[model samples]
Target chain A: MNNALPRWVDYGLMPLISVIVAFVISGLVVLFVGESPVQAALLMAKGAFGSGYNIGFTLFYATTFIFTGLAVAVAFHAGLFNIGGEGQAYVGGLGVALVCLSLDSVFPWWITFPFAIIAGALFGALWAFIPAILQAKRGSHIVITTIMFNFIASALMVYLLAGPLQKSANLGPRSRDFAEGGQIPKLGGLFRPLGIDMGASPLNVSFALALIMALVVWIIIWRTRFGYEMRTLGISPRAARYAGMSEVRLVVLAMMLSGALAGMMALNPVMGDQARLQLDFVEGAGFVGIAVALMGRSHPAGIVPAAILFGGLYQGGSELAFDMPNITRDMIVLIQGLVILFAGAMGSLFTPAIVRLLTGVGVMPK
Target chain B: METILQLLDLTVRSAVPLLLACLAGLYSERSGIVDIGLEGKMLGGAFAAAAAAAVTGSVWLGLLAGIFVSVLLALVHGFASITNKGNQIVSGVAINFIAAGAAALLGNAWFNQGGRTPQLQSEQRFNPIELPLAETLSSVPVLGPTYQQLISGHNLIAYFAFAMVPITWWVLFRTRFGLRLRAVGENPAAVDTAGISVSWARYRAVICCGILCGIAGAYLSIGVSAGFVKDMTAGRGFIALAALIFAKWRPVSAMWACLLFGFLGAIEIRYQGVALPVLGVVPVQLMQALPYILTVVLLAGFIGKAIPPRAGGVPYTKER
Candidate 1:
């Protein structure tokens, strides 16, 4: 029970359990529709990673998730739920798009790219700053505020994309494609010599950028003084204040950083991947960030693998229904849901035993 | 004058589902567990009601099925947060995600319209009530036409939603059960001292919350519209949660807040294509976001502070 290996096993158990649960649930679904669950699962696996293109595409999707998961994880560690990551990411995408479209004629790709990223980050930070300021000053719960902000941002994006920023060639609610100079150069062709063709895959320099950012985030959280203050504030605001930390500034900073990381998710997709903005384009990554946060347990190091797992599901699930008509991509979402449920119900697994054993030991006095 | 009356009628119909959902949140949060998953439960109930109605061709049976399904979800939520001592917010999120995917999966499989149900005929749907006596009252004066058209023209659920305000007030303030429920939320240890079961009170409150959410969903799918669509509830549930906070978790106040949000929704949807010179073609999307923006602002400032029950989310473990 006290072994480190067993502790690691416990940590690894939930993801494996969730996949099994998902398979069982999907099996039931297949049974209802008169299909073999194993065949459906096999089809799903093949659809996900059958080709080099599939692997590239899956990694591409994971790259965006990495940014979002890190965003949620960072904010969660600060004891704040950053559900507004969706809205922030949307705004961040807009910021990056606007910068790319406007500056393509004047600046080179190298200069414009970093500027776009900074612009995205600032916009995201400002978006998050609203809720942080309100929570710190007026004691408004962040949960409600962040959720409300999400709606506002979604609406704002729809309006912008449908009207002011609508692409001239496109008749829908989407922005114009970025200038040629602004597009991320493909590394897939470079990898083609090794039998990898990354055509139509959104992954590029952004995936590496995301991993590096994750490492930087881990350092900031575990080593920096600001992170110490944020963690302390997360645990107990009163204690932090007594320890001479500014609670208001730390709270605002935490949210701003959270939003900034979220902004990078947009950067990964829009600049290094999609090169265009569409309505509901992020496809609820903001809300899904909550799951990633829970699954990762708010640890930056933990979030990398967690994000990749989700990324694989996204990659695999999309192709499931195509290969196997009975098993839909929705199974991925359901499995994610099951993982969240198991993770959330973690207390039920051991609370009774822990309490009884502790009470028996006289640790909890009668 | 007639235009104004029509708008008022629209407001009432639009507000009914939101009002009911807000009332549901009022019950759950007042008992001390944050019900962010109300959106999911409402959506689940809506899908269940629509599917049930489509299968059985009976509105009444569909409504019951909807409530039953929603209550089951709330039970799951209660079990996790109340019994397992898990984080209430996280558990609520889990319920929402599960409901979203599960309902969509089932809906797609059964209906084959990508999580949407087939529209029902007039006989299969809930019919709005028409009062013959209100015909004579339409010409009396300024109030007569308003009353006849706005108040008397809604379907049964609209009236039920309006009636629920006073009923909720009476149940929460007048009844002994309400007192014990509130007691359990505020201080479960004290309720335990008083020989009342905290767990039972909370469980019952959550069940009531589910029933109310079910009614809200039924109103959305059947009473307001003819069929269920993916995420048809949109963010109405969150607005309901906001209304709960705005009303300080008081049922009557929640009613007014819901009406306000419903009015905004009605205006946005009704006036989408109309070009106002002053507002410069107000996009439907911008108007759709008005309620959320308003909620954030109110929660941050004008509503002042609404405190939750101190022991709301904590699981009540009996000490032997």
Candidate 2:
């Protein structure tokens, strides 16, 4: 029985337990809001997966989060909290849109897409490198600097949207739409040969790209000399320095890679699907990725499931609200909050007891 | 000069909530609990106060409720950080996200005003109190004007906020409990060896933070405005944190830091309509970005020397 408890609490059930706790806490919120929790859950399920279109929309949502989650997890492995994902993504989208607008007629679709991706990655790398260099050279705290970067990016984007990038035709504060050639093709028609039309979901080739990127991250993190250096530095910077690893270079490189992954998210939704960079292109996907990264326990592969779950919440919550009057889109935000709270608290809530139980046995080293 | 005096008055009024929050941060952080969740606790208190006032038509009771809920969150934070030895930053982040989401959720249900509460009447909110002594002192000179403008025409909460600075300094330095608390923050092992529980001292500090943050939040919704808005604390918690660092964890200096930021905020808001002819139209975005720009510059320059406690983020685990 003692060993059973430890076995039962393995990594497999971690996300499950986290989800259960999230549901319970969010259920209380629903009760407070005077809505039946069961009905709300049912509606969310129906909205998220009722039709093939809903499932496709869910995949579209997942694609962006997966990139962001990977970005966050990469930094987490290197012992950095890059909350500047939002800023990086914003800049990346802007860079891509600028590229698309300037080169739409000159370059073919293949060339233009590659150019947009490169622009995004470069801008994201530059955005992250500033704080990374500051932390490495000046002993500046990464968390504070990255958080400040988020605000700066928000203000910068707001200013640009309201002034320079303001669409001449639309009265609202949004940028002009990209040309038709920039839009990513839908996968439903391609899959229709096998009678697999996934309906109206925006899930595209980006989903496949996200999966490939996850594998690349996993390999880069686990099988390379740079990965070893990063893990060591994350655990102990002084130790890594003694081992001949350059803290300055590694910090900058880690942040660049992180930003590069985050930048790819812009390709998924903003550049690929929307074919334009509007003010709400990413729509807080960067911040939401933080919650996904935490719940995924900062693993590249682990983040895919976490991202999809959150994406489901977004897609489903929107659908539920459209179907029902009482349940609003804000419920999804509440659920995200609850999931983060539970996941953060989980380590403290059970780790000590589990440690004790496992240590007494032959299974664990004391 | 008249505009300067008016601006000074506005600065004092604006400085109140931030000053109180900085003191709250000072108390908790001095004892080793990094209370970044001050923003969340403040939101909780603000929402509670606004709702209670709207329903009961009693601002005093509403303010009391705000204090109570803020302290409750402080206790929760203390338990999580001190007792469970959880990550302080993560705990605070969760609290912030929870408060943000919860407030909006509840507001949607209760008011149906789209994530905001209904505006209460003037009588249902706290109003500024003008001093009778200001009339007699109006003729005294520049000093008289300074006193009248800076001190006499602020809400009750503003005056109370000023009083908290010295009170905080006294409690943090003069008292035995404060000494032990500071000791725990700097070196918990030493405090533990001295027969005091590190967890308990830290818990007490967090509770102090909660009460102060509650007052700060109440001042926002009741003393400053008539209603509660979604995410209305609006990065003020972070400003309080910056003020805490700029003061180098000293209560008295922290008060001055609050005033500096407060003055900046007041100027930004007041300068919106009344701009210099040469400058033309001043965008609200610039003003919104002002405090953040100031924070980045201040932290990057003059306050780089400020060091956090040695064990600020590391949780204390007692080996019994």
Candidate 3:
């Protein structure tokens, strides 16, 4: 069989096909739950794109997904799977909360935001450091260690939130609200000056920050010397060694960078939206990152669109649940799971058949 | 003394599911398929068992249904990893997500109780069975009371969990199927060349894994508690995987490791508000995190090296 298909077919067409298959399967699931799949689809599209408010919420979710998707993509480039993005984001939220609580009264929003970002990145990097070092030096697998850390991070967060961080006046397991100066301005306000009513949504300056981070990731991965070494290590560790690249250093650096990107995800939820630290702010965005990275083929250009698509699914799924009583939130999760299963695990299921067709048509170089 | 015995009982109670799941993982991973989907299978089983028992009012039927669903999931994993040559971990993660979502969706739709199945009646649940001579033995000294508290008065599944350790060891070491399974994990090509179909060996191993995980799930819903809860497995499957590694993939050692984790779990529950002598008010969260922390420490080679099967996680292709 000819294996000389164009890059677009390999990267673009395959993911598109997988996603369509997944949606068909999900539509069947919706039908199983006694709902009209067509109506659900229409409702979802409208919910995700109908009004400025809906679009704003979608962008807000997309922002977080972008950060996390980039996190997974960066690590994948180095041949590492960083499943601990959830934990890193959780700890990074803690970092943001700490910085906000301590400096909110003294510093302005601009001053505190940078400190919060640094702290979030540092804490996230620290969380990833142990697994990175283990993988680099001890030959221990990164997947297991990162998974364990996720659980540990949850427990630690529970402890902090319920014990020390809980407000004196409140009994809930959440930190007190941030000072006015520390809260990032919502994008809704920015749009007011342009005579466009974006409505009430969590969309904020962090969305722009997330885009900037994606650009930075692209430059670092494609242009920088460190990224070249990291890619070399991923492609062939022996070849990298022969070329005098330090595998250990590259592994650690790649993981730390991945964790930092994941940490930045907390900024959107905690600082930009919640204006306070809360349990489970990260939700399953970390896990969703894996699917986004897979569907995007681990490229920033691909991840941006993939993240937006997922964000639409999430926002629209909620609307479907609200409109249709039979379809619950869990049903939405089931659909997301099906999508992940197809796009990530069964991603190459149609590759061989497509290759055969493309070669038979003489579209590929034989 | 009584507190110690009660703690021991709680440890046994908690250890049963972990023991079963860890042994299940041992079967699949021993044959070269990394079964990280143990959690998902267990969740699927728990939901099936709970739903079936609620409708049928028969725990035995529920157990069968649970096993059926779990085996179906196992077949899905096998098809993806073995036939499609997909990434095992990704497949497992997907399975976890599917189980979590499907359980909630079905539970709410069927029962209309917000993603939770109806609570099982006494007749539909596994109740503790008192052993013969337990009343007479309770009057005796240490051994009798110890046996009465720790051994005699538990559900049937606990005994099955304990028995499975030796049974697994015997099957893996003494049986022909066991030899082929281990050989396939270490080197599938060599096993294939020896006229043993590697896929068949792996399929059998994964199926066995499903059965074990199904029992673990059933035990959680019908035996341990009354009905299913969302995310009830609650990362126990991952802990079981950790136990599998901690035991170096050995059955007997896996039991011991699971027991240790169970003890930790029991301690966390029993000493929620108690202050210890040296530690002074040991936080429940810290205790909850201990098992994972220890797993990380072990994986980092702080305890000992855990070398996986040589051919593990690599899809076997004949042409390659």
Candidate 4:
């Protein structure tokens, strides 16, 4: 679909058109549900950004999305679809849980946070390693393996939560809450010294960490030698091989790094927000990352805003559901699905038209 | 002996949906359109069938409605991937998400049972058909019990599922349309040069896939269960895909693969808390995860290379 058009129009106008189309369709759906689309949209905006607390919550959700989005982007750069981010994040939660449970009472927050980070990365990487090895060595398709791993991870989480990790006295399928030392400091506390009040939202120091990770990903993907080799392989494996790059090594390395990023996503929910290990903590964020990656064009800079947009949707959709009687939670999911459909799948639906218009306007060479 | 018969019966019942879905995948993938939206189509069909049956009280109408909804979704996939040349997998994934959300929203609106339709009446459902002379055959020896247990009591659609295997095989291998379909999957350029429209063949194939997936969905709500539950297909569509791959995309092999997966599911349900010798008490979650783990193992080329259609995921562009 790439054509002789300005890069901004190619990346910006096309996606904007797709998003507008999606929202228009979603508005019709909302009308069918006997709700006012205008009201719903207004409420969503208010809920997502009106108050300090709402902004905090939105940013918190965005923090997790940033991690998972980068995870998907990293893999996309290597021509791999790492759909197993959900599973990787799940196992990564288990890592955080283990660190919090065993050492929270004994160690300080500074010490436990770093250890948990390493544990999360290792567990996520280990989860991804099997599929990576299979793809690299046995020629198994990465998409199917990663998808299967998601279900496997869900089942594994259910088992561990019920059998070994279940809190001793609690009957629910969740681990015991972490101690104070294991819990990350909330942003509300950080803002106390200033005149501004951030409110008691779950937005924590992890948000800053997420931003740092994004920068790191940008550097790794754009600046490093490994990044060049990965992009070369993604563009043409035959060319990479001709240049004496080891396809197997790069495939495994890329997947591991992707998995590690997905695993780091768990830190936000487990350590920052939930302060405990719970079943389905990853929810659908890992899958949502695919939409993020696609809409962002797998660029770090693009991914940050894409993640924030989806985070706003998540937060705002809940608010709409709360405010309206006819509009249910599923309706919000339906809208999100429509967004994903238009933005990711039917992305090229309007590109040719735009390209033609641009050419007719003498904006670019035909 | 009785337990074994019961197990076999349950396996057939469980395998029926998987068989239909696997064949559905086979048709689409053979025509070179990879369908990960089988789960979504099945879910949509199940909801449509159940809702229509509850409203109209006609099982046949329910079946038609289900097929209509599934085909509608398949058309969406076709438009995105075939007409627009978009990513097929992303389209399929989007379809799944849309179906999951739509089923929940519409089911709740229609039935008010939190995304579940009303329980279907017996006459409005596809009840098991007791074969003629089953009682007389019961008087016979070993073969009598086997026939009665295995084949006699399944719904009409289950029989259709079993019959589809040979039909699919015949259509794919012996018929002219089948040759063109297979040719398109392997090399659309060749098919195009030979004067067959690649997109038309793919659209027809996807529509056929939709009908099969519709049957699989209808069987779930009206035949096996009594109503539609939110996301009731429960990854069976995906497992059917695994079965399709496990069978190397052949019709007869797909049947065997579905049956194998069905047996594993039967074991999971029948022996939920049963203890075994070496492994001790097997966890239910382990049993639930077995099919997927096995799929991963199979996909790793442990058994053999599971080759897909040569041009399976690639969208056909005439200029390209």
Model 2 lDDT per residue over A12-122, tens place: 455667778788888887877678888888888887777777878888899899989889889988988887898898888878878888877676667788788888888
Which pairs clash in the backbone of model 3?
none
State the lDDT at B46 in candidate 3. Answer: 95
The order by descending lDDT is 3, 4, 2, 1
Worst 10 residues of 3 chain B by lDDT: B311-320
Stronger candidate by lDDT (1 vs 2): 2
True-vs-predicted CA distance for residue A294, candidate 2, Å: 1.6
Compared with the true structure, what per-residue lDDT tens digits does model 2 show for residues B1-320?
Answer: 67888888887777788888899998898888887788889998898888888889899988998899899888878877887776677678777777777777787788888777889889888897888888789779887787777778788888899888888888889999989888988999999988898988998899989998988998999888998998788878877877787788898888898888788788777886576689877776776666666666555654457677777877888778
TM-score, cand. 3 vs. native: 0.97
What is the C-alpha DockQ of each candidate?
0.65, 0.50, 0.79, 0.75
**CAPRI class of candidate 1:** medium
The second chain of candidate 4 has a TM-score of: 0.98
* Per-candidate fnat, comma-separated: 0.61, 0.36, 0.74, 0.69
Q: Worst ten-residue run, lDDT, model 2 chain A?
A: A1-10
Off by over 4 Å in 3: A1-3, A190-196, A360-362
Over 4 Å off, model 1: A1-6, A345-347, A350-366, B273-283, B317-320
Q: Encode model 3's per-residue lDDT on B232-285: one tens digit a residue.
A: 999999999999999999999999999999999999999998988888998899
Which 10 consecutive residues of model 4 chain B have the lowest summed lDDT?
A: B105-114
Counting clashing residue pairs in each candidate, in order, gives 0, 0, 0, 0
Query: Candidate 2, overall lDDT?
Result: 0.80
TM-score of each: 0.93, 0.92, 0.97, 0.97
- What's the lDDT for residue A104 in model 2? 71
Which model is ahead, 2 or 3, in terms of TM-score? 3
Q: For candidate 3, give the DockQ.
A: 0.79
**lDDT for each residue of candidate 4 in B130-173, tens digit (9 for 90 to 100):** 99888789868888898888879999999999999999999999
